[model samples]
Target: MGRRRRRKPKWVPERAIVGELDRRGRAVVAAGEDGRPREAHVDGALPGESIEYLRCDREGPVDAARTLEVLEPAPDRVAARCPHYGVCGGCSLMHMDPDAQVAFKQATLLADFASHGVEPERVLPALRGPTWRYRRRARLGAKLVPGKGKVVVGFREKDRRFIADLSTCEILAGPAQGPLADDPGRLISALSELIGSLSIAARTPQIEVSAGDRELALVLRVLDPPSAEDLDRLRAFAAQYELRIFLQPKGLDTVAPLETGRELLHYGLPDFEVELGFRPTDFVQINAPLNRAMIARVVELLELEADHRVLDLFCGLGNFSLALARRAAQVVGVEGDAALVERAQANAAANAMTNLSFEQRDLYKEPGAFEWPGGPFDRVLLDPPRSGAAGIVEHFEAIAAPRVVYVACSPETLARDAATLCSRHGYRLAAAGVMDMFPHTAHVESIALFER
Candidate 1:
């Protein structure tokens, strides 16, 4: 018996809806004659701007939408520098002026604090640096579309799974500095056939970019081994652009340089007289200048003394541990990744720092499972991931650190942790402010000082 013919789903009509911007910089409107208030999060929107958006779909209690037109643009609204601004998902908030972007970030932090019924006693001046060409690391998507007859390399499209076709990236390939920076499209196009061949077999899907002060490394995630001819082509391309190419067949541990005797990538903190060597895939700050500034700020806020001992948690590769050790009598760093711990230890030794030490432990698990030095710690520094440091915060009293400084990338998680440290542990939020670690985007990197 023949099955009944299936009908295609009707397309949802696009409606022009207007709304005011909410704290998140999204155009928001309550339930009204226009549409459901919860349904509108208009992209490319700024506060105080009346924008027209096409309702797309419902996302939980909120409505997802796309900005159609700005009937009355906000005063701070400016032209986005990147040609791929609206279409590329890599950056948002670029429409707003750079200064306004920082202000919005500060406001977001304050609003998050308010939601938790807490506020910082003082807010520090926002820290900022070069907004463009500041990104030192990026994971670019690589795909081959036969229909397009080329390889596409860049970020994914906004709110979509498909990659956005990009010739160059302003963020990573700073201001046409070199062949790698000026025309990344040429690099991808040159290697398109090889990449496309592997991609068709579901072998290589992504390329990670990590640039140091002098060197740039591209780690290609390959699902299968490449032929000798492919290696020759890759080597030639690498030599042409002065790029260090590493291929990963399965895991991060499997990543190895195409040729032996490759140079190691490193960045220097001249102020602290410290240089840190790292693998391309390691977790280093994408913005180099901001990182130097951030380390300085953290050290200043901690008020480190030669006699004071510091504890650095989530200390990836001893970026903070080595820096703190330079000032403090002793700095102990703990991280979950054993490889990072080894790297941190090696970094300390390379800098000839005998006072700093690092340990490997799953901080989220039972603290007692791993032995930690009994601490009458004078101060503590935390640079946790987005999940926040709930595990560490829960055991603050046990550590008995008089002062605590938290560096966070997520305001929501920071707010949650702040509440716990204050209400549950009798710590006061002394000073907090946003850092422009990621500009042209909604990401908020913040630091908060807490005292018991």
Candidate 2:
């Protein structure tokens, strides 16, 4: 008997689809012969704007597609500033007007709240700042593509595993006065060959970029020890660009500065009169102006007094804790990471803030699993991650704080926690609004106030 022949996978051809944008800015439509609904999140398409799209692939019921042509452009649609807008995945909503972008974010937040059967009594004005050149921190991908004969350094390609060849990054804050400002790509191209010489270049994934008001630092994540020549080249590159270079052979603990007796990187909170020193790997907000704005807003909402005691949960580097300390009689910060807790304490001490104290504890643990100190305070502040503070909210009654301010990065999780607080804990949603921490991206950072 002849051997059975193997069947080849069928080729799926791209087809035109018309769709309208939903709340999340994705185009929702029914395409193909079956007429099933599919969500195509094309970057440039906006709500009420009809567009032609080419279906790329399907994930369950949704068909991922790219905008082939905008048959009818939205009134808010504008030209994107970045030359690499479509190819680079860094900024998704650049084509939309700035005002429209914020409106979309507000609408999306409201939709998220509605989904969870919660709504704020008042929607605060959206907090916004500089739209371009606002990013002070970024993790850039680096790869030495031998076939291309050069290194590609930038963000990843749109929906692809490969890195985008970026000639310039409009959103990234460039050097004040140097060639780097004119051609930021030179930073990677100059070091491409040197990085290729290293044995771990294949495994080295990324170079972390951290920029302060005064200095820019690059942390190279290396998988293996560098040769003597490699070190020399790195030092030379640092000296030439006036940048502080750090080498990381393993984890965050392994990151070290190449030059001896170098000053640490810091950003100033001029309004609060606080200066925060942090390592390259430390977690700091990417946008400086917006962070300062957010902090001021938090202080205003807390209505802190000299006799009031406050609690700050998930406090990192004392960004909000130190500021709260200035207004409140005393502030206690709690964090899960020991390193961040230590840093927060050091920052408080450096600022001569005797009213502030920090402790390291797993905040997500069960209510009685871990002991919380210096709580049952007058006011409480929680700046949780994207996962939200479910663990803390589960035990909110134990703290019994009258007013609670939640700074959240995810609306879905925030809505979930809001539902828990309002429905279960008898707290009312006073006000909520979105902060434009990352412009041109779908990321939403927001703050909400709750009171009983």
Candidate 3:
């Protein structure tokens, strides 16, 4: 017995392996029957081209064996036009099929309040407009590269520092007037030639291209002071492009027109014959068509009347205030920024809207004490930022506006404030709905009508 004969393990043939070689765990990443990751599995499958299936890592109470449930069609839903749609992380629901987007947003509003045991009389239809290239304002990021002999400008990659090497953005309505989405590098090169560094900012990640009813005012964010040659280059480019340029040397306080003539960026509410004069960096809605729809929705919700006195809080450039003034007897717009108030006043005057007046008062700090032109409004419209009007929720009760229209960009904040309105302020959640302002994005823009 030669050291108690040891037994060797037999080798299993590769052919005996189970499943395809590319199959990894629960997901089979092999090319689909056609190609591309399978139409994002409407069920548990992940829509990706990798051979590995990642484990569910989402926190909270997600069922381990949960599967996705597809809903019915919505009229507003459509196939997202941008190729950079999913990866850019800017838009979320692009693939959801149009009308579905509206349904989802509507459902989001309903779900927000169902937990709070509140319901509105109606969940209105989602407000919609052109689905692609509708953004009128965009703030594209810029970076200079030494070896590339130029710079790069566009939105940052989804949740990352790097920029998406995109050529065209169909969502930007004014893309045609500027460099095509695929060619942002051209804009970067132009700016690099004109200045040491350059950046662009607009309400949307896309810049407004057309000098439509409004002039094309571009805010060129600078990292350092431009040299004289740089200024001349920029001036010439602006002249050739027929665009107005503003320089941001420091914080927003330092923003000013590089070349000031009588030219103005004046967007219009064509339906109302209202011409709104806005400088670059003003908080105008990026989608002109959607803005018109939102205004119409607000007016419809407010049931504005000649005798109605409305208070628009956080009113930027009097978008809602002027619209309210057209119908209401008096409209008081309050804002935290003095510069915006001045612009709002100018816009009101330019439109010749007699009943609206704007005031500069911080709602979060000096919410109630500041003297406003009109008081005791019959209705109040609140368009606070993502933080919601937490500091002023209580003031709503004291003011006793018969109706309140809260336009919110965040649903969690809307729900929180809605709770306050119903629970603490003795107001009823009358109606709530979502607007497709930023479609394909997780950002939810909501409008909730409250009655006291």
Candidate 4:
């Protein structure tokens, strides 16, 4: 028996009168014909542009296609900075100007609110930060291609799972920015080359990257153990580049340093006179400067007083809790991960703050299994993951806090929760706005305030 040949889907080239940008930042068009209009999302286009695209994918209600050419360009479109702009899935909206990018995201957030009949009284000015070289955390895919006889390392190609063959990246927060430091050597090329030359390149599937205030680290996800010679090569590479290397043979918890006695990864919050630490594999914001700005804005919306007690939900390693403790009288930080809870406890002790505490419990579990924290809390803050705090938000009445602030990564979830808070609960949606946390991508990070 022989393997059957795979048949390629036949694509029909069609020109679309593209309309507004959808939630994912792709241009939408009316594709249906039976007295109904179904949105056909076309990439590589802006609003009002006529684009030639090949329609080949059907994603539920919407058809997906990649743009072949823009028959007419939109006024807001701009030249992309990186050469790998369209191919690299790491960024979308690079063709649109920064202002336009933020505006599109803002519209997306507001429109989501409008759909739910929950409008913010005021749209806070979108929180903007440095657009390029701002990503402090990333995971680059590594794959060994036998035909090319090389390991391709970078972000996955758009609409595909394979890694893009990248020589340089404009958005990676690599080292060497001072007057005399070399530019070309500090970015993606050197890292890609180093990984390519390794003996265990095939077994290494991905590399996790993290940057603190003063240090950067890399953790390689290796499926198999490396040989003694492979260790030597990795060590030489690390020493030459002033890099910290770790290897994970299995789970994230299994990550171990290639070199011992190294510094623990950490970042500082100078605004609150606090410094926090974490493992390289831990979750942190992709943008550092924006995270700081966001925290300030959050504190403002929270309106914390010296006598007020704050409840921080989904608090990972006290990122916001420690800062909140600086202003509020008492703070309780709750997390699902026991390790992160321990880290949060250690951070509170190190900061010499006795006003904050962290407790570990799975927040998504069925109700009544876990006791909701009974509170005379004056303020509440929720920063749940994309599966926005449904099980938790419905229970906020138990806390009966006068104010609530939500930091969200998904606008859809945020809007849904906003409606819940307003309709079922007595809170009002006061204000909401987007943040450029992952600039150039359609990933929306936003904040909202609710008052009773």
Best-performing candidate as measured by TM-score: 4
The Cα local distance difference test for each model comes to 0.81, 0.81, 0.64, 0.85
Q: How many clashes (backbone atoms < 3 Å, residues ≥3 apart in a chain or on different chains) does model 4 have?
A: 0
Q: Backbone clashes in each candidate structure, one number apiece?
A: 3, 0, 22, 0
Q: Model 1: residues >4 Å from true position, as ranges?
A: 1-25, 33-38, 173-202, 368-371
RMSD of 1: 3.3
Please write out the lDDT profile of model 1 over residues 1-452, one tens digit for every residue: 99997653333534443455554456665565555445567777766666666666666777666777787877898998878888988887789899988988998899899899889999999999888778888887887676888777778888678888876566764223456665444454445554765423246788888888777888898877887777877887788787888998888889899878773688888888989989989999989889999999999999999999998989999988888988999898989999899889888888998998788888889863445674768999989999998877876777767799999999999999999899989999999999999988888999999997
The C-alpha stretches of model 4 lying farther than 4 A from their native spots are 1-9, 32-39, 175-186, 367-374
Off-target runs (Cα >4 Å) in candidate 3 are 1-80, 146-150, 175-212, 366-373
Which digits, one per residue and each the tens of the lDDT, describe model 3 over residues 219-288?
Answer: 7666556667667776887786556777776677777788767435777776666878776676778778
Query: Where's the lowest-lDDT run of ten residues in candidate 1?
Result: 8-17
What lDDT does candidate 2 reach at residue 385? 90
Residue lDDT tens for model 2, 265-301: 8888988899998887899998988999999999999
Model 4: ten consecutive residues of lowest lDDT = 176-185
Q: Residue 273 in model 2: shift from native, Å?
A: 0.6
